[model samples]
Target: MNRWMRPLVWAALLGTSVAGAQGIELLPGTPRPLDIRAASPCTFVTVMNRGTTPATLEGEWVNGVNSVPVAFDAPAVPMCEAAGTALTPIQPQRARTVRVKVNSAALGTLLGRRSVLEGHLVLRAAQGGPAILTPLAVEKPSLLGRTGVQRLLWPFVLACLFILGVALRVRRALGQEMFAAEWAPEKSWGSNLALITGLITTVGGVTKIAESVTPLVTLTGVVFTLLGLAAPLLYRATLHSLAAHPDRQAGPVWGYLLASLLTLWGAFGGLITLGALLDSLANRLSGTSDDLLGTLVMVLTFLIVLAVIVFSWQRLVQNIDEQLVAAPKRHRQSALL
Candidate 1:
């Protein structure tokens, strides 16, 4: 046989002997129980033997307390003959049972009702050397507590809001005749201003979405901001186009300006709200409260912005109505002249 093959054959023979000699594998056995009456002790059973040559087996269980180690007494059976004065050398195919008795105090320290046990098992070679087959573990007690919230709520809410927003915008866009108009030089100036405001608001909304740590409320803020900014820009463009045509009557420029301002206000408010929400979520996750003052400032900013949007929106609507009513009389006079 080749040199590599010789070691492989020897390892196979050793494995066969070890398997035959194993009366009970410790890992497969039931662990010693915990949480009995205060005075009750615990018991564990295991078996071990050398595979190829004679070897002595010795072990001790270490409880979690600071007490000295306790060793197990040898069993009465002499299944394998002694190799020397040291101890019995376990032969290739022989096996023996080993029992461990743990005192109540040790059991309490090692495996309490609600506490965890942490330790290791070691196996030593007979030629006076280091050990093998060391297994370590941390045992946990049964748990009891709340499991927390369901994961599906946020996604469902977002889907509903998205659908609602899209439907409303689409209905307005398709049914309204307000969007078809020719562009005029004077009206273009107002549209450009609205466009600038819309761009700023869009940037703020994107920032909010990017920082969304809490889904529903933060996402709501982002969407509202984006829509608010977009509405004014759309209105401005449509009005400018209509007024540019000599035959068409454009609404007052001030109404569109006020609308744009409201949209921008609403968007900025939303950005602040979402940013505050994200800061709060971060604090909760990390178990720290460093940004409490910043959060309060953000809340205050949102409130002020909300008030501005509401006021501006009302004013813009009233102005637009007045402008629309007066435009026709002005157009008629111009035609007669």
Candidate 2:
């Protein structure tokens, strides 16, 4: 739900595309970069020349930023060398295998480190029509590389950011309403609807990503499913139950916020598989075994949070009811005077 989980989900989703990687051949009619991602030291790109006349291919590793030189030998590896493409051009209607070897030692430095190096491999014809800008992201063997994520991943992230921002704003508005003791149906009603929606969904998918944490965390999902449904049930029982308690504290705002975040993290694509776990306190400083003596800690965490929500709302309602009951007595006293 916090730092580790975000990238963990990001990488988990990206990693799925890696298994789909298969042999590819480039055609001459349209120019597209042979994007590659691999944990291995060597990456190969197949280039096919379907054009007339001989064409020569040249490559350069334009280290956009000079720091991490993972693409060090990108230029040296001559692809389509079956026909001596190094010295001679490939005749028309032929193919070549472009092997790009990464400095594993340099890339190895990124393992256990939470970082990635990005660089471009520029592939072009010596006659120079258009260059294929092959973007290469070299990192830990288990994380994302060669992910053709430009089409879908970025847009999804932007949408998630927008949703997260809105959730936080709603939580803030609810808090402000309770603090000011000026809850208005016109003003706060929309936020309460948002809260009800979040609470229900968050519980349904709370432990969906439990396997990534511990296989045992899944029981919480079942429990939260019922727990999360309660908000909706309350509405069904009394359409105005929530409306009556306008001056109510937002229970476990942070917990609810994180639950909302985790729901998205688990529901969206899990692109990466963590080949190695980063050593941090989240793993109890042991970052070791994947065995399952597991339990539902995330559930317990949410249980406590939801309990606070119910408890605070009940207390607020009782206080408000007492004031309403006493209001008539005070009015009668003023009339008698």
Candidate 3:
């Protein structure tokens, strides 16, 4: 992905000589300087080309001396670190939305404290002509403001309650006569481990999002982030154990098929999560380098799991009619003869 970035693109966008109107205007009325906020941080200002000529509007976010980071993967917006962000040529009298992202962390660092970004969006014209300087300001609200606590607590609380409900249901199911021989509470080590690790990861994720609170929160996030890396594997093991239980032999083909589907879903989670974790770790360790190892691993895992799901489903379908036919013929054939 880094190879896609050329130094020339950055130079061309950032090195424009002059600054003026440039025949393009911010639509829905020009935004007030201090009215802009970073709580939502992403602003979608419509750029209208009032001139007869088709014009290109490229955005460069800068705080006089420093550049703010723009996330390229933001939905509905196209941004690149090298080329900056640009909109398609708007013909005369046409409008298009231009997304401007303010980096709060960079803003904080610039001001030497937690604060919002007060910057300008440098909109450049074709052939390195004059630029339109649009003022931008960010607003950083308090950490505990407006449903902040609710957002943190509800998802975590609901997830925990759901997990507890599942544990109780499993316990009840195991006590039933049909599943008594198949499920042993003593042998549920894999499920237990997944439960513990998943809960820790969930808690860590919640607190990590609320990281402005304390150093302990950040440390918890780092520790569980590493520990959570094993979740997919443990989850897979639990699903595999449940699906391959001896009692499944007595159930219908649909039941087995459902188990196979569950197994496939579990495998997907395991493979994708593991690959993401590996990619993140590799990126952190390597620093400014990129590789395809994680992608390759994920692709291979997908193919293997897909094949397993397909084969199992096909086998189940083939056996369905055979089982149905044999059932009626067992005692009826003797009676008819």
Candidate 4:
């Protein structure tokens, strides 16, 4: 996908797409719920009752953070010939202009720690059919708000956390296969240094790339991140014990077995999917950028990731014996020198 359009595709993948309501459709898309501030809480929206029977609308504003002392109003007001009528049911094929108002008093009640007093106003027919959910946010500009540090840097920070999670999971999965293969573990300070350095570089590079694509401006991203860290830790700690006692090495055939293939596939596949979900969340904020080519290039790197996955699987399955033999050959060559 083109960088210009890839994010839209990813968004569709990550975002929860609400199906079109069979009996209700909302209108006046301007001043979207999240885009409007508390200073302008009252918005007039038109809601059409598409069903054959007349139906009244019921709605509630669900708070996203601190208990903002307010109620979101969605009342069917008068419209057309005479003037808009007060909160009433709409006849078949008729529409009503709803006075969707949020009490501005919420700004006072919010704890200083929270940045936004956000919520969604869900409108559904009292008779019941399908409902429409409109997400809204009232930003506390002095804090995180829609711009500033939260929009520019927070996404990258979240992305780093997500990368760390995926890397740890990959390490755990590789350790499992290596243990079965009885692959020699290099017990030295070099291994620790290389691991730490690689992690730092990887996170730093990714964060820089995300920073280049700042100001995505979103609240939906919150639903996406976390996990892949807790899961790998929960796995049995067999690799550590195996590394400690190299004398009881398992046969190379163990790594080539069908169970070993399944093990690697399961770990890589599931954790990678989890990683994408978190990554999309990072994108959900920094998802948009002016430089399309850079965005495109960043996405193309997934090809490299897929290459690594394939190589890791092949390293164990296709040439297990060869890999094992080469390791000892290298060890002997080094010892002779």
Candidate 5:
């Protein structure tokens, strides 16, 4: 503790505080620069404009000590890819997330073992203003798994269960003579297509959890997504047509069970698959940001459809239980006679 150096330290700290307060403030909860082991390294950071006027950000990643420009992925922010520049406009006092993906090779060289690579994210105002510098650091851990393959496995499992449910429903429905007799004519093609598409959608969704979507995956997903949405209507039409025919006396128990299974499964599973597809599209169009309004509408529709299906299923189950109870009583009454 040199007496002369102590005063200078206070002045430097005070100046740093004033500069931070004046310019863009890195929002709280912004992720610390992550350790990179994967070939493609990405991280999310948020910033707030504290200035009175509206400001746009023009970002650059630079080596902190030598001040050399570091090549990195551009259009880092989601949903604000406005034309030529990678500039993101922020209303004063508002916060926005900026996605940063640095070149792994360049970053690796700068980061040796025990080498803490410090850098600066320089955000210049779109209107030719002085840059705001935010310090950055990242560890080069040997392995990184933040892509969340493990987390996505749950959804893949759900999708698989949904597929199994659909298959069982199809098998049960086909076992009915009435349904089997009518099935092969007009509706067979659509049903087969639906099955194929459903499988593709499920497989594609699982793949998406691990890897990027290729054109083949996208195309198959599109077909599968469309069929998933349409399969319910096809089921409804077939069921209604069968119910209208008097000659088709598919026993009540089997009919009701299959109907309940198919209707509930179609509505519930269809919505889940549809949501996944739409989410994929939304992500592609708007980076990782959500489509809030679209999601709200989908959620509401799902609730309504789910409520109707559950009510119908409960009623069918109740009726089946009543018939079972009455059948035992009738048999006992006949024995007494």
Candidate 6:
């Protein structure tokens, strides 16, 4: 080989050695699944210059999509250098360890819907040349899964059950005759509220079950239709009862008020559930106008339910206070006579 060719040969051999030795190797000492639970500190290791001439190795983290290189200060080490790559020195036959502290955001981006951390380790020779890359994976602690409306079912059911139990207890304690005669208006209103709430619960439960069972949105449409039908009937019934017998007993007014509040809350929840079902159905079916209309209906239903609940609660409280004040005055007058 010519004198110039000899140097080129050496450079090529050095490059090959650096490339082979400098790539990332998972450290045997590290945990098999990198534990990255919560927003805590983490580290990853790569061996440098395993079988190559001494060279300096530079390190960086890069985004997989945009290929934007993020630089970190190269650790002190003797590693072979390659042309045109970030330069760091690594000693021959020695492993250079790289430590990386991943932030929560970066970990989340790399995880990609998995409750685990994942990314690539890009290792370059100290002499500034192409990087040898390897994939890195870390496990995120499995806490409770993602929370949404779907996860709220148990709590909602428990709330409904608790309210119903209280209402039943109040009714039994008050006695059937006194409940019917003294608090007739409130009783009527409460009964109507219970029926509406129960219907909504059943409809919402069915819709939830359907969503869990199948991904098809058409099923959701059927559920929404049922709720929509139920809503109008409930509204009419409640309105008629409230109009026909506006009076409420002072003693049982608190119980009615509590039931009314629960009913309103349940109605709002049902409206939200129905709206979601409608959106799912509309997305599956054609026609943008229909989807828009469905969404509008959902919003209106939520607002209306909220307003009714607020108004009814205020009325119940007022009646309860009035009766309490009047009862004291009447008793005093009777005692004097």
Provide TM-scores for the models: 0.27, 0.26, 0.33, 0.30, 0.30, 0.32
Better of 2 and 4 by lDDT: 4
Summed over model 4, clashes come to 3
**Candidate 3 C-alpha lDDT tens digits along 1-337:** 1422322334345564333245676654554433122243465566667678888655556755676653321234343222344445668887776555555565544421123455666665453455555556554332211233432343244334433443343343322212111222243322233234334434534554332333333333333333333433332333322254543323333332333333333333333333333333443444411335534444554575456445534443333323332142122111000
The whole-model C-alpha lDDT of candidate 2 against the native structure comes to 0.35
Error of 5 at 53 (Å): 40
Q: Candidates' lDDT values, in order?
A: 0.37, 0.35, 0.40, 0.40, 0.44, 0.40
**Model 2, stretches more than 4 Å misplaced?**
1-40, 67-88, 103-114, 126-129, 140-277, 280-337
Q: Which candidate comes out best when scored by lDDT?
A: 5
Residue 49 local lDDT, model 6:
60
Residue 306's lDDT in candidate 3: 59
Residue 336's lDDT within candidate 2 is 3
Candidate closest to the true structure, highest TM-score: 3
lDDT of 5 by residue, 162-252 (tens): 4454445444333432221123324333234345445655576656742233343344445444543454444344443335555442233
Residue-by-residue lDDT tens digits, candidate 4, 41-141: 55566778788898877655554333333222344443212223456677789876766555455554442322345455556777876556555555433
The clash count for each model shown is 3, 13, 2, 3, 0, 28
Q: Candidate 6 — number of clashing residue pairs?
A: 28
Error of 1 at 127 (Å): 53
Error of 1 at 196 (Å): 9.2
Which is the winner by lDDT between candidate 3 and candidate 5?
Answer: 5
Give the CA lDDT, 0 to 100, for residue 10 in model 5.
Answer: 37
Between candidates 4 and 5, the one scoring higher on lDDT is 5
